[model samples]
Target chain A: MNIPLLSLKSILSRPLSTLLSWLLMSFGVTIVVLILLVSAQLKNEISKNAQGIDLVVGAKGSPLQLILCNIFHVDFPTGNISLKEANNLSRNRYIESAIPMSLGDSYRGYRIVGTTKAYGDLYGAEIQSGQWFEEDMKAVVGANVANLLGLNLGSQFQSQHGMSEEGEEHEEQSIIVAGILAPSSTILDDLILVSIPSIWNVHEHEEEPGEHEGEIIDLPKLGIAVSQEQLEEEEITSILIKYRSPMAAVMLPRMVNEVGNFQAASPAYETARLFNIIGVGVDVVNIIGILIVVISAISVFIALLHSLKDRKYDIAIMRSMGATRRQIFVHVLMEGLLIAILGCISGLVLAHAAIGILAFYLEKLNLSWSFFVNDEVWVLTGGLIIGMLAAIIPAGLAYKTDISKTLSKA
Target chain B: MIQIAGLSHCFSDNVVISYPDWQVADGEHSLILGASGSGKTTLLHLMSGLLKPTNGSVIFDTQEINQLSPSRMDKFRGAHVGLIFQKPHLIAALTVKENIKLSTFLGKKPEHNRHIEEMLDSLGLIELAHRKVHQLSQGQAQRVAIARALINHPKFVFGDEPTASLDDESCMKVVELLKRQSDQHGATLVIATHDQRVKNHFSNKLEL
Candidate 1:
């Protein structure tokens, strides 16, 4: 009938080759799209969670580990730093604000971070229900922590000693969920927030059983105003610092590393370094995906050229039936274009479905990716260009078919 | 009516075939008789505007087709002429009815499913309308080709050895169908074949 319908029938006439070209194209597109989604989301997650914090000053260890532990919460803490030394560094004029976090305990694999109200402010966190923790043992749960662990207001759970579920539970120090934070699309959504004293009290009960029995020392809330004696004896994990001025960016990290027993790491510098280290593997895989797409284009070219040999007489017959050279040319080109359009659309669908499944399994990372992106339009356009390139020569050959000679051969 | 004057085609420097002047009135059935290598197919191709002659003009009702551009010639031939070859060159991917429908599609004629069905009915192919072309016998495929050629109701029907490979009974049957279909559609029938079995059917002849 019409050229498009005729082109479709011609493509269907040879099933195996068409399938091969289609599968290769879709496979290549899937790989390319998946990589784009993951890398973009990874960069977004890293930067968003690390916003506002100028430096992470923790125990003497790998600066990257210090950042990973205190900022991103994906790695183990280097060790603990004395509260006296950390408080002294917080008093430095270059530091605008400092939030002290004491991390070591968990409840059902979600880390229970102990800090003041400023930690919630750092991420623009808002309470979704109930209220913020007001007492030492009262806890505020992140949106993800609340949903995943089914924690609601007044839900009581004891702290575990370590970050994993197998850690020893401190039954005597039960923590009650005081409130739940709204989803902020940051690392805050994956944590449980408690006061610093809650973590210290849980450990102090085990370390010195009856010595600090009824002496519930409520330290001042705003500036971490512990007595000199208490500050000397207590230890905390890390302090997240914001710079007072741009000059602090150059002068502060050096001051902490040289003057105090601490390692200060810049979140911006470390994440870029991390991406550079991961980029080599990403580039290699991206190259392979592009190579597969190019090969599929070649496969399409060869298939069309090969089929043209058998269909020469058929094309001649169409010409005899009054098909113009241009019509014949467009008919052949439409086949290739059809294959590309089909392959690109299916590839995008396959890629999105795969990412959805991956995001489901890796939900603990709190990663979110979109189903459609602007870069995929380029992928579609590239596919169509390749399709046209592959079909042009074959279509031109069909256009030049000598009708009288071909029909006379019979 | 069709008119041809000073028709000759050149294949190469040393090979040229010239055709004598001829004219056929409207709705007349004529045969071009010749042996192998006698330019019968070439003359048929020129008359149908499939090929442009080196020195000739084919006039159909005062329209000089050879003077038309390639694109216009193709549209002209599609609108006014239908062709059949020695082998039924049906596109294998399409069914029997689809093959007939292709004529109306390419000829830029308005599609009429009823006309296609009637054509197939008269050809005794109504039952096999949905079957793929490869499944049909030689005679059956040729009949499908005839149905395709007549689908657009073209002014001229050209057959180049339409029944060359069939037995005597099938050959005569095909010739009868061609004449009958052309007559029904008010088309002039022009067939080029060396088969002696075809001579008894057509009274007008051009021999080379």
Candidate 2:
């Protein structure tokens, strides 16, 4: 008891050494904390955005890319599926909801996703003010779109050809901001949402009206519209199905994927695959963490061995006062353990502060990452283990030191 | 009370000292006299239970310390053996009083503030009680170690070349101080030294 207390005081006296070990240990721990924060946030964002939708049926290109573009709001869709195929899928009894999405327009690099009221309802997204789009070329802005573009409920803007920085398009069709959505803390907060008919009408006027031959004749019947008189089917980009029974879970998706031109994807499967992909990187982080801990242990061992020369007389005196070799051993090891604890605490605090600073950027990317996530308890636990593990080598050295030889050398 | 029989020690397989028998009675003031390699320090280390004898036994009262496990011996030593080293081994990070309090904490005893204050008062160290050990002069730090050694009220006290680093005048004063305190506490006192300045102070002498 006296020896451990004495050893603690000795460490506190040597401020520079204590601080050096603390900083070194913190360096390794901070990286581990940062990786967990970023990965978990990205995973959470993808899963949250994938909610409510059961299937994403797109053109026979990259199903992952189409899902990314339409649902997760990243990259370009591989291609579009036919309207007839979309309509036939909606006719299935297992399909509870269908939301058509048309892309290929932007307002100042922010995407303009031409969708319907059903799109908002699928996710239970609400309008902050005004109403959903009831007219063609009308739009409802996301929270970020409203904030970044400074668009009010009645404000009007023009659409661009793509989300590129080239500034190539001059042709503009006026788009009125009919409604704005409350922030969902998801991908919904960043897009310019509008009715699907608005996108169809934009291509209708792509040419100079007088120079185009019979443009008027093709225009009226050009786009597919849902008829008021009930039809057995209708065309759309994708149909998100919610099964009334688990039988549909087994039967309907297989039926949709195999029997039709459209391909069905479960958001659940895609999310699982996304996690598996990210897990490879996490495995690398764990390896690096283990390596850092090993290095930290070696550092502690060397530093302690280095300090033992100066501590010889001190150990001898304690020995003379009836402290056993084992007591001296515990005393030295305790000093190392103290250094580890200091490092672990500092590392955890550093990690929390780093996440707090990056929160804004994370939000901008529509990825919600909290510094104090559920797994942080494990991170702290792991960091402490690393710190203690690092101390063991030093402790072992201290244990093996020959007290008589050491005192004689002095 | 203490007893040593056929105690011997070696460093790097080289014999440093071998003694056939030695003993000090309770409340005796004994001085061990020797040249550089005479094993006076080795005798003190064995007597205080800091070093295990390569041969024979060191009995403090009835306990043969060579047989006690290192950790158990540390507890026994902390509780009953008070040691003052040649150079003060006071922890540099702690204030004077905190260093003294560490003994109590390690010994698992409630703080005896009255005894500490009395020790400090007798040694004229009360005013320096809050100063860091690093801030103390050699003489002042030596006096602090003396105070720390006596604070535990041990039955025996060991001083290893305690005055070797001090000036003549300070060395004489330190010896007088240690002798008077040992007498006041009725504790056996052993001084292992070649200083010769403390020769006349101890009534009982062991020549090596």
Candidate 3:
């Protein structure tokens, strides 16, 4: 006579109500859990790629868009800036090291970056093949680029004129894959690295010193004056700056933005702003999840209350068979708890299943998604609390049931 | 053996039942006869410790049932008493054998299938032991309820309108079965009902 087993059997005897309650409970849990999963993955990917660089100096535009474009590589560059002005700013006493990156052409949607060897050092990217790009037109492909594009050492590929795959290809210069970097499991694993001259000669990622977006009116003649050689030393897409100390964080972005046509964006500040925007959407989802849980609790409460009426005679019979009021109370509570636990399990599986689908899309970007994070544990705790809370009043009713009255009624 | 003294029960100042004192020796079988609302069921609840009398004491053997706490009373009842209601309230999801074994389970006694098998065989419900309670006919389900009551081999058995809804033949068979089973186990039996057909089955009868 396992009393709990008997209670569970009683619950199972009414399959429709149990299933309805369980499904509702899982719906609440699944929404909360899926939100946690997606947010956790996004945070991890953002912070991992945003580390090391404190501020990004780029063509004047939206600061968040600048960080999104240069630091995270998720958007396009905001035109271009003079390399001379960016370098002079990099020489500030508060600056630790500045790495210049120019992005324009791509190979099959993977951005081909032209930067110094210091850029590789910033991400700790190790060369797994011949060597890092040593000369113009010599390129080092990241592991994902190598795997996805099947680029091997000595393989040569033509670059497209812009960030997108549909952008016209620069067929004149076929850049050779001088090296392939090992997988760093970061945004670095999705890029193609080459010398700065390679990007200029290929698609002219530069612009006149004061030209921001107005050059679009003279697109056909934009690259005529800056010879291939002059373009190399004249412009770069953006300069990634790291502060020597925390105090520099307060003054550097302010000074850089005040001085040049380039706007400075802190990855930390911008990413947080991005998440704040994303947070609003997530807050709405959280409310919906909580509403689902609240409705399910009401459902459980009503279901249990009705079942109590239905089981009054049965409860009286159990009392006659030696069950205490406390036993009966625990029996009812256990029924609610069982439904909650089942919901938690099903919701977790559902959350991970949704994440599994997200992972397929993220994989193309060389990003990783994982489950079983701290957020999931919090969601599990939430589920149990809801279950226990839902059962309280119903269990109390069972506790106060008058056995004799119920038997006589039957 | 059971003894009741100075028994009275009230319902919110609306109705009160003042029961006549009665004493029954061990192994005795008795019937409580009454009209509707005559308090036959109330007296039985008091005797079985299911209800606390407004002003009275019930002594079953050496235990003061009314004086015991609810938990202790439940334990005492599971070990020493059995009850059958007007309708069989056996859990519909469980099999006949599982329903009967619930008595031993609630008593916290290590389950013994032998006791269940004996009760089923004696009640001629062995063939239906594995069937869900919902599949049983009214008489068969009633017999299973009886088997559950006897699984603990209780010293006392109480029934409230156990055969009120049955036909004449089925009612007699149920009474005879209860009588024969109680005789074989040397247990006392008390039944409260409004059914006139069950009147002749008990020689020791209380009429209200």
Candidate 4:
């Protein structure tokens, strides 16, 4: 009997219009919320995984590809650079530290990277169980890699020649999991760490079989003690460099690209460029989502306006029953507001549910699907405003209804 | 008591309708008898505070109602007056009981579920209390309207051709219910109608 209850009943009285408006509103909200969630997560993951690396020096190729391959590990290496050339560049006075990465092997779908312990330090990754690899044949599995592939300490698995499941398995040199890294919210969680020689050993066995058979050659511990001559002749995919001073940011990439056989790509510059390129598509879809929301608002407006025609007599009846003009006006407005509130709440629920589904399927992305976001408050407020806007005219009309004239007509 | 002095309303420059000065004491049942174009509905509307008169004063007890502000007038009408139109005009969305309760809500009267139940029981609508207004018969809908009007126990109850659409038996039944309910609630009853059958029921009639 109260205005709110009456308003709700009035909305339900015309079920088709109410449902139509609600669906449009909820659909629009779902699109907008989903876009916000995905873009936020993508930006977060990109920047977080690329943290601390000042430059990526790989064999001359697309700088974006070099970054994607060496830093993000989502693409193929831009061919290998000579370890000797990379080591020479690492010795530059402007270079604080350089972590060499030897790619081109995988176990299951997770890439097995050949690097020193410094690569783990780059992402603040620490051993979760057992210990870091102490020998060339041992491996440290990332948290995701361990969990996804069920790899534990002492689990021996031969490396595959390429990154996919169909790649050739190098059965001659089986690597044992020495440890597992704790979960770090970075691309590191999707990689396996081993000594650089492990990749060389796996490939060398296939290239020159029986050449070192029965020879009493001492194995390097974690491959760090390898001879300079051996290291110079070997090839690695890229070197991730940290600048010693801000001056390196101005002088280093140009020096490496012009003087050395390799190209140095700034991780920050390349990722920003990547986002700029992707932003067009994001903006187009975002516009579409917003357009839908606008259309839903219009739909709400039309529905309310249309229903006002049929409810004129009802308004007059309420007037006769002692409802003030303000009460009548507010009652109409409340109908629209109720629709908006319902649509907004349901849209948010739907968006979160959709994110949950996406997270379930796209597990490799490692997105954190939060139930709430700050931007949603604006969305809610916008919905209520639209609802109020749509109903204001109709409510005004109801407020001005001539009770005597309307009732006398019947 | 309700008093009307110099009451007149104009739809336009040449279509003005004037009413004679009259008074109805508290608890007295009265009738406004006239044809369709004789301004019976206009006078009823003025008395009930539904329309502002172009030139007039309708004083309920000692306070002049037409002089009251629009909001105050609405509140006064809701609290002290009940209106029953020719058609039931029940809000189709509301159940029969809710239609009755709407009066109490808008009139700012304290709702008594027991009173509403007893009101519906007296109207023989207790069985159909939860039914939608549109589901009721023509006579039943008018009864629901009567129930709504009397829900707040208003001092004055006005009916404008309330039983105009009913057959003779139903019309008399509706008039009987209106009079009985108003008497039970200690309310003065005033009805405007062209039907001659309603004249036999009211001795205190104002003819225009």
What CAPRI class is candidate 1? medium
lDDT of 4 at A175: 93
Clashing pairs in 3: A1-B105
- Order of all candidates by DockQ, from best down to worst? 4, 1, 3, 2
lDDT of each: 0.88, 0.73, 0.83, 0.87
Q: Which stretches of candidate 2 lie over 4 Å from their true place?
A: A1-8, A92-96, A164-173, A206-282, A322-329, A367-374, A397-409, B4-23, B54-70, B112-121, B124-132
Count of backbone collisions within predicted model 1: 0
Q: Pick the candidate with the highest lDDT.
A: 1
- Give the residue spans of candidate 3 off by over 4 A: A204-233, A364-369
Work out the iRMS of candidate 1. 0.9
Better of 2 and 3 by DockQ: 3
Candidate 4 chain A minimal-lDDT segment of 10 residues: A214-223
Output the number of the TM-score-best candidate.
4
The candidate, 3 or 4, that scores higher on lDDT is 4
Tens-place lDDT digits, model 3, residues A332-382: 999888888898899888878877877787674432335568878877888
Model 3 residue A281 CA deviation in Å: 0.6
Docking class of 4: high
lDDT of 4 at A267: 87
